[model samples]
Target: MESIYWVLTWACHRRCRHCYEDRFRPYLRADLEAVVAEAERNAPLVLGNLPKRMTYRDPGGPDLPEKMGRVIISGGEALLEAVRERVTYPVIEGLVARYRDTGGVKVVLQTTGDLLTPAIVREVAQRGVWMISVAGIDDFHVGMEGEAKRPPSRRRSRQ
Candidate 1:
């Protein structure tokens, strides 16, 4: 079973000083059909893509394998409040359901864990998603975003 990490968007609510350039942008909706098509064709262990906000390119051009090993969903902050307010959760849920139906791919949710709440976690778990929190230790602020603006404590957690 191979794995592929997909970057869904760059838009986020919190303005972390250490945030990456890609984080400050609008969300771009990829062509899910194309992405799935490609995945079915390529049994990649690890796959990642830029967020919808980062590019206008159509991702609905390839055919993916039906039995992918794993699928990772990521974004500027996978659990960003704004994203959740918008449509991140629904999209994630839909994808998870589709993948699970195949009984071949395991969905992994990559998040910062900042905006994530107990309810959200429970919902994700119910959908059979494996949550993976990404965070940085020591100078976490510096690593998150290059520019140092506010106090380290005020800055968003690296995760």
Candidate 2:
């Protein structure tokens, strides 16, 4: 496989007309923590076994094989304030640290710009996110108001 398209959560801050996902869930902190732990344990092995095609060359150095390829993280909005700093950030950091030596894992974050702030952008960039794909800006996904579509408070216990 070329890259892992990881959906961190189905919860979103928008109810876009064009969205493919019809149902959303309010993912709790523990749920996210558990996911992070699981990913941390298994992701490297899965990625390592994938076909390595990317090659990295350094000045006055030999070409090195890229062990892991890329990790594309997406969600209703991965940058949503509810889970950004706690869950999402840790995943990005962990991936970067794990594959920093072997040509580095290209971490791509996908989101809608509704919840992104300058500080958050800066932090993710620093944490080795190679790209941020902003989506849902067209007429189908207009009306950025999030209250109507917002899932129940993520802090609430799952019923």
By lDDT, who's the top model here?
A: 2
Each candidate's TM vs. the true structure? 0.51, 0.63
Write model 2 residue lDDT over 98-141, tens digit each, in one string.
66655667889998777777988899999889999877554566
> What's the true lDDT of residue 18 in model 1?
62
Clash counts for the predictions, in order:
25, 0
lDDT of 1 at 88: 51
Residue 66, candidate 1: alpha-carbon lDDT: 38
Candidate 1 residue 58 Cα shift, in angstroms, is 30
Please report, in order, the local distance difference test score of every candidate based on alpha carbons.
0.52, 0.66
Worst lDDT 10-window in candidate 2: 50-59
Segments in model 2 whose C-alpha atoms lie over 4 Å from true places: 25-68, 144-159
lDDT of 1 by residue, 70-154 (tens): 6677765556544553445555565554454445356678765555678988877876676555553324543344434434767
**What's the lDDT for candidate 2?**
0.66
lDDT of 1 at 131: 58
Error of 1 at 17 (Å): 6.6
